[model samples]
Target: MKNSKKLFRIMTMCLMIVMMMSVTVFAEGEATEYVPKLYSTAWALVPPVVAITLALITKEVYSSLFVGIAVGGIFYGGGNFERTITHVLNDGLIGVLSDPYNVGILIFLVILGAMVSLMNRAGGSAAFGRWAGQHIKTRVGAQITTIILGCLIFIDDYFNCLTVGSVMRPITDKHNVSRAKLAYLIDSTAAPICIIAPISSWAAAVTGFVPGEDGLSVFVQAIPFNFYALFTILMMLGLVLLKVDYGPMKLHEDNAKKGDIFTTGARPYAYNEDDGKKENTKGHVLDLLIPIFSLIVFCVIGMIYTGGFFSGESIVTAFSNADASVGLALGSFFALVVTILLYVLRKALTFKECMDCIPEGFKSMVPAIMILTFAWALKAMTDSLGAAPFVEGIMKGNAEALMNFLPAVIFLVGCFLAFATGTSWGTFGILIPIVVGVFSNDHQMMIIAISACMAGAVCGDHCSPISDTTIMASAGSQSDHVNHVSTQIPYAATVAVISCITYIIAGFTKSAAISLGFGLIAVLGTLAFIRSREKANGTYIE
Candidate 1:
């Protein structure tokens, strides 16, 4: 079965190459602006299609994405093969290594690793395990708790995803609640909440990318149009109440029932590692709390520092000059130093054990880093080749003619870009620039367009199995990424179908109150039904 899957991936990759080549020859004239205009829209669409087709058929995200990236690079950089290769090295690989944006992400991941390790090594994980083992007695309670945590952490998607997974995994595992379920809970909460929240990194990112006359006004105007984001949060609430596990997620539930489990953290959990000096039990709740609180506080301080609270510069100027990577690194280091001292003072583990734990924790993040690098590479190559411009031209130029169906069309387009690139941020970045450009000029259309961009990017990420949220969900759950993708796809599709309808109605009405009113009611009503059905079937009962 594995061999066949591998073969299928190879064949699909070959097909993508052929399609790209054909497009290069046929539409060579149009791409003169960028890379000789090798592939027309018709041709450009082939890579994502092929990538998705292969991922669905072969169930290999990494291979599928790499193939898509290669196709894009080859198509865009074909004339300058050596230069293209160099570009991938300099721009794709080293760019990720050197750029402030990419480096900041890496530092954040490392800090997250350190924090998780500190918690686990200090016996904070075990304490939670013991506490949850005693308190979270029922399946329904477990799922609900997972959802609640997801909702509570609305400050940022990265914070939400990593912290929720790290803290909850042990508790979820203790209750025999599948990791896949935990992953879904985390994944659903992260982007969905970030989109809806007035203050979040996602919102800030949008603000940064959008060229605007009034930052506050533009943001306020955009609230109504962010349909998918609002709808997805509704869907998450619905899923929590209903316990509807369909698609790949359903399989994960079944696997959990059969006791299929994988752990992807510290070596101490593996049971095979015999280096056991009896694990630390002195690590109290405060050991975890201190580091976590410190991390958060330091991050805020870092933000302030960057924003010029200390520097005497204007906040905007300071922020513009700040490097997120440096902030994350410094914050993490501070947290790590403080947390290590706590452990030493508490005797949670010896100094050596603490030291060993840090390296292991960082090592655990390797897969995530690799996935991010390749994902970014694919995004850079496509963006350089005018992918966003092409999509924007098509969508904006046709918005007036296709007024009623604009929501569904935009939603689908956002989904396509997210799925292809596996990064909602990237998809959001591309769409916002274009959508803001189109909508900022007109009041009526701006609300709808901006909202569509938000909804579309989020919807795409929610569905795309290749997306980082999906990957983190799978990784955190210890489920196969493909399995998680397959399971979550159906549920995502259902919500999207409903969301599209919501978008269409909202567009024509152009009344935030009306759109939100009817939309929330419809989503809640659907969730109630699903919950009732699940309870009746004994799938979930409170």
Candidate 2:
């Protein structure tokens, strides 16, 4: 596989170089603004598509992302060698890395890692696990508690992903749940719950993008028809309640039951010994709860702070304008300080012991950090090539002909765009306006169409390996990133397929009651078939 990827890179790079040298200049023409032939065309989406496809196939995100970035540079640079190099370096990598928001997220990631390390060193995680093991006797209870915590943290997906994962990982681990399964749970709850929640950042983003309409009102109406999100919630409960497993997730879970939680030997993360040492036996349930609660409180305050809550905006308006990256970084930073101080005051860990966790936490987060940086850089390449405009054009161009099938079509488009770009917010931001323009407010399918758009974005982001929430989920669960992505994709894809069908039903019926009822039936029916098949094949886990 490595050799093939290397060969592919060599050939593609050579082809790009040859193309660069072979192009002819129009010396006869007067000076004009330079424009790449691929600009705003369907080809604009090719780079991200290539990246996403290769990442899934190769199981190597870094090289896949770089290849995609190079492809985008080729498209944008128009076969100019010097320009391609300059564009890839200056406009792509540096541009994204230098963005204040991106930097803030990286900082937050590192800080969150440090705090998690400190908590471990203080024995908070171990203590919580011991407590949960006694009270949460069944695996179903452990999974349900994780889901509930994830739902409660709906203010932001990133927050939900990390907080739920950190708090629940110990409990899940004790019950022999695979890290991959934990990641799937964290990820499924993160975006799916947030996208549907009325008071979430996702809600704020959706509202801000819809022009000339009351965004919140539309969001509220569309909630019932958000088949993907709602069905996903149902799917998770069914998985836990029925105690069934299928797909790649089943393999991991089966292995976990044998005591190999990871199912693979690839060691991406190095555990901190500070947490396991004999020096710290003073950990308590409050040691974990206080810091986690404090982090949540400070993070919320930080978000409102950024939105100028003190400066005069209403709560909704403030949320709409809040800088999540900045707020999270700020909130986590302060939260870390409070945790360290609390540990020191409680004599759980010395001041120096808490301070020592800073570097340890940073080390743990390095994998996620690298993946996020590359993903951001790749997104930048796509942006520079005008992928957003290209996507918007596709949505607008086919609207008239696909009117009856608009909801399904929009859902598919939303899935593809969000999957390629690894961002649900950006996908919806691009499509929501086009959907609005195509269907008037009075149109029967208008709200349904909008719901399809939101559902698809969340579905795509839920599966995309490069998504920040996905990355956060892996970090939170302390799972191998690729393992989490690979195992979760099948599960996410199942929900997406059912969701697409539900959208078709919705398009025709234009009624949430009929659409939602059929959607629920379809999901439950599919799961029953899977379970029966597993039992028939003698492969059922139980």
Candidate 3:
């Protein structure tokens, strides 16, 4: 397709998503206390439906998000009247920005943008690609690389999806690996890793949405109960060892083996296509490694500082109390400064050239910033309508009946919501109120429930055709969307099953370590069995 058509479609989609989100936000804020229960639930979830509709129609992420935001705003604006426009501005836009949680996410994203820019300018991404390319020779190796990289970059899912996808795409492609497979790998690892990782931005975002609990401390406690994440990671590891080909995933592998390749979406920066294009133009590989190392080192130190690590506080306590945005921003700034120095010293370009990369880096993040802003608007709208109270009431009641199966049930529900809405954060936000209210007294059960919520959302979002991570993963791998979704479901489900079992055991034992350890053993045993069977058949995909 022509660039103009693509751009037009993209803009149209964004407008739709924006409109839906705006309606939702505005409607909730202006909703009357006497509003009907059914109407309120419809109002609360309208953005997601609109988002999916736009995505399916436009086949674009930004467009879908924009439309979702707009629908949310319209709902909040009350029947899409002109008079409600003022409310959207005052209540939706202002409210979203003023939110402490939203503000933190914005700051974190902006800084992440800067850091990514520095990484690109410093050649860190390319360096990582070069390093990964040398070792990942087989399909199993590719899957493992994607999983490990996803786990390593637990600071944020957005960062993980984009960066890992960018770095690994070339290697995966070279091995005749399907773009769909690569997308699966990226999506699978993205949220699952963040949901489990204590210091990540997902934790920060989820913590912010939770009420009546110290956002940070609650997250720390919640980590132990996050059985979905623990199990998902194990599943990834199991897939690597066993190489089990099942369901749609098996067909995808078969297609890939036959060299069937398909790709869609806008060609954003043309960054993923050719690895060697800038190799000689860029400085030595260390130019990349140094900036990345510095970025990681400083980010950790920064998180520590915000948490007041040396002030005689516990590590978990410090993390919970830390100013995450400031920490992430400062760390990114530090990396940027270091990147410039490296560029100058290496004579890769003049000072002017070095300075030019900053804006260029930020330019790449415009899409992310826009989508995030719209998402925030949707959140504000839903909250204003008292969506949380209703959801909490329902989930809490349901939990009473299924407390014994809370882990598995929450996992399933989380996945369903995320798949339908195309957002793990939204799923997490909606579920938190329910989980918190239901398991407030039972700390053990609460942990299990919350973990399942986070994990289940990630798992479903990882493979869902509509999910942004799924889209980005496909875009990064330049793969077909249906192909990716079809192939990944089985592997994800396998993990889901094991993860559910682990959560049940954890609830009884109230021990995270034992549950995780025993769960890993079970996953490995499952993998070994699959491997032995595959060897016997000699036709994994078939």
Q: Rate the local accuracy (lDDT) of all candidates.
A: 0.67, 0.84, 0.65
How many residue pairs collide in each prediction? 12, 0, 46
Task: Please state the error at residue 467 of candidate 2 in Å.
Answer: 1.7
**Pick by TM-score: which candidate is best?**
2
Indicate the TM-score of model 3: 0.74
What local lDDT does model 2 show for residue 87? 76
Which model, 2 or 3, shows the larger lDDT?
A: 2
Q: Candidate 3 residues 411-496, lDDT tens each?
A: 88787667655678777888877888877888667766777788788877875655656655654454654456556777777777
Tens digits of per-residue lDDT, candidate 2, 1-542, equal 78767766774687566656735522223388666778888777788787777777766777777888888888887766666777789988898889999899889888888888888889898888888988999778988999889889998988888788878987888888889999989998999998889877789889988888899998988999898899989999999888887888999989988888888875477464335563355689888999999999989888888989989998877887788989899999999989998999999999988888899889988888888888887788778778899888777878989987889999988888888888998988898888888887455578888898999899888888778888889888888888888898887888889889888887887888888888889889989999999899898876
- 1-542: candidate 1 lDDT, tens digit per residue: 68868787568667566644444332234444545365435455555665666677776667777676666666666544544555557766677677777777777887677667767767777677677778888666777787788888765666677777877776676666666567667788888887776555566566666675554456667776676677766776666555666555665565665665432222222431222234457656676678878877776567547556586876544544444456556666787888888888877877998888777677767667776676677666666666666776776677667765665677778887787656776776766666666555567766676677677787778777656666666555545566556666776677777777777887688777787787788777877776677778876533
Candidate 3 has an lDDT of 0.65
Every model's TM-score: 0.85, 0.94, 0.74
Candidate 1 vs candidate 2: which has greater TM-score? 2
Query: How many Å off is the CA of 355 in candidate 2?
Result: 1.4
After best superposition, candidate 3 residue 155: deviation in angstroms? 4.1
By lDDT, who's the top model here? 2
